[model samples]
Every structure is written in C-alpha cells, then in structure tokens.
Target: MEAGLTERSDEKGEEEYVLLDLDAVMEHVSIRPDTPYVLTGLDTLNPMLIIDGKVKLIGEYEETIGTCLVFSENEAPVLHKETGPSDANLFSGRCIVDPNQVPSKEVKPVARLQKVLKFRLLLDGVDDAQQDHPSTEGNASNQSTATQN
Candidate 1:
C-alpha cells in the first residue's frame, strides 16, 4: 500500500493538519493483538493515522519512533489489557502508537517521508471459517441425505 497526505481539523477543530495514510501502513505491515512495534520516520507534528478517510492522531512522538500496539477486531472486549480505560478509541484493527519518537528539528514541510514499521502475528485463537466448513463433496452428500429424509 502507498502512503498519502491529507488535511484534517486539529484537536480543538480550530486548525487543519496533515493526515497520514494508516490503511496503507496496515496493508504493508502485519497487525496482531497485544504486539508492540516501532514505526519510524513519521511526521512528528502531524503524526496521525487515516482510517476510512478519517484522521486520528496516533500519539505524540519525539524523533519519529513510536511504540505501537496492534489489536485484532475480535479483541475489542478485552482491549483493556493493551490500552488503558479509554472507551473513546478508534477500532478496526487498532494500532496504538506510543508517544516517544521526538523529532530532532522543528516541524516543517517534508519533501518525502519513508517509514519502516515492524509487526507480529498473534494467531492465538484465530480460525479460518472456510477451512472449518465442509468441502463440496460433503455438502453434496449432506444435501442428498436431506432430500432423501
């Protein structure tokens, strides 16, 4: 996935800021529940993620390195283990970027920004629905049996 830039309203909805492409990031990286990762080379001032075209601030960073946590869509109920008590959070395979990466210089317009993010896979109770279902032969046999009955 490729990254793109967009403008978004600030915290107080008073100013507009740049939004980072998060869907692209997720597509490029693997996201698992309860995993920590380091996303480098992000725009510190406008360090936000874009989901469904909506802008969301990941967190404040110092030097472009932020510790992030990826959570599965199915783990919403037990998300407290990864994040604190914050019901108002963005879902859809959550990636929580820690406020650490501090920029060396002040915020400025970057010609190009490339980031390398590391992610892990957490297949604890994951199951493939297609694999669990019966095969074509089994389905045909079952249909025949049902018709006979």
Candidate 2:
C-alpha cells in the first residue's frame, strides 16, 4: 500500500512485494460483457475449436430457407444445418426456466483485467486529389482500359 509497491503474504508466511502501475489497472473494460469477443493468438482455421463453446450459451434458433441459424451468447447468429424429421430432439420443444430456479446472487468475474489496451488509427500519406484535375495524353497515369481482347 506504500507508494507503488503492493505487499502480500504468501501461504508460507513469506512477505512478497510486487511493483505495479495502479493507474493502468482497469476493473471495467470498454467492451460489452454480454457480447462474445474473439481473442485468440493461435489458429482460427479450425473455427469449430473457437465456435463450439457458443452452442452451450442461452439462445434461440431460427430456420431459414436452406439452413437454421442458432444464436450465441449475445444473440449473435451462427449458421447450423436444419434439423430434419428422424432426428430425436427435432420437435422436442423450447427450454423453460422457472423463476424460482434463478440464482439470487450475481457472480462477478474473478479474472483481473490488469492491462488496458488502447489502439489508434495512424493513416500516413492520405492526401486528397484536386477537383477537376487535368490529364495529358502522354501521362503515364492515364492508361487506357481497352484490352487486347
């Protein structure tokens, strides 16, 4: 608690002092919690690896012309194959929850979002062209679109 050093006692009764910039510690992020945010540093090609967990979230499904769209965490739609007749749970029905079954206490996330990330768009050399610019016949930039065909 003194200055910038945070002190904490370990299970072994040993004192550990860690240095941290407290101002950069963010409890609230700019993004929405209900919305699903994709953040993986690894391969996204096997999208099922990244997408499979979404089917467990609370959402509804819609049947389109060819495919059925199932929604994810934030009501984000995910395309799925239509459930045909012979399927066991095809017409089982919607899931219903009783009001008394809902938990009373709200669970706050235990994960600490220590680092605050900020990004700026730095576009270099974006100049506007003059209106009604004149072009010369011999100008290299004035190439004809006519092809050999």
Candidate 3:
C-alpha cells in the first residue's frame, strides 16, 4: 500500500503504485502535535488490510513517531513494540515496501486498497464508523461499492 507519494515510478516494468507524500498526507489529515496516526495496511498483505485510520497517544520514540511506511519483503517480520503499560503492539503486516529493506533508496508506501480508502476518508475529514460514533461516510466500502454498484 502506498502512503508517502502522490505518484508512482516506472522501474523494472513493475506497475507504479500510488503513493502520497507523507507531509501532504499529514497536512491533509490535519495531524496535530504529538498525535500518532495508526494506519492499518502495514499489518497485512491484503489490499484492504487497513481497517481504519486513527490518531492515538503513544510513548515518545526516538523516531519521528508519525505514520511510518514499512516496505514489504517476501516475508516480513511482525512489528512488536511495547510503548507502555497494558499496551502490547504487534503488527504482522506486509506492505509493498520491503520490511527488511534499510531504504538505501528513498521510497514510499503505495496506495493499497486500505490506504486509498483511509486517505480519501481522511482527506474528507472522517474516520471509520466503528471507531467514531459520529458517522459521516466513514465506510471504506462506500466508494468501492458506489463504483461497483
């Protein structure tokens, strides 16, 4: 899933994936200070792996601590981090970017189904219905359904 650039590259005859720049995505989402945006697609290989887009409070990390774009490999490792008490985070997600990749070259996450849905919703300033009680087209399937139906 692409999440860091708005366009794709044509390399090795590989289909370019849709990726939005991180800064643009954050600005579009209006991420506030110290807010951690939890994007779901990084945990699964499926196109629609991301269940929703959310912002949460997390312990400070040395990294920038925003939405990180994890690349995928043939086999990606689960992301397990312990931020605080009672919080055991485990992400067995796979993305287009290689997980083991040290990013010798700069790349971004492509727009997988979940990332696209989440980004569109975020651009419109809405969250998934399951998390947000106030519903305003929070359904990811809304667009896909509308297009199909």
Error of 3 at 14 (Å): 24
Residues 1-149, candidate 2: write the lDDT tens digits. Answer: 12222334577884421111112212322322243422222121111101122311111122223321111122223333434546676434444334545334322221122222222221244331221233211211211111110
Better of 2 and 3 by lDDT: 3
Off by over 4 Å in 1: 1-21, 38-44, 48-149
How should the candidates be ordered by TM-score, best one leading? 3, 1, 2
- Overall local distance difference test of candidate 2: 0.24
Q: lDDT of all predictions, in order shown?
A: 0.29, 0.24, 0.32
Clashes of each: 7, 0, 18
User: What's model 3's lDDT at 8?
Assistant: 47
Worst 10 residues of 3 by lDDT: 140-149
Superposed by TM-score, candidate 3 places the C-alpha of residue 95 at a distance from the truth, in angstroms, of: 48
Q: How far does residue 31 in candidate 1 sit from its true spot (Å)?
A: 1.2
Could you report the Cα RMSD, in angstroms, for every candidate shown? 26.1, 26.2, 19.3
Give lDDT tens digits, candidate 1, residues 1-149. Answer: 01222323476763322222234446545434333333222433222222222222243322223322211122122122244446675553465434464323222221222232222232345432223322211110111000000
Instruction: Score candidate 1 by lDDT.
Output: 0.29
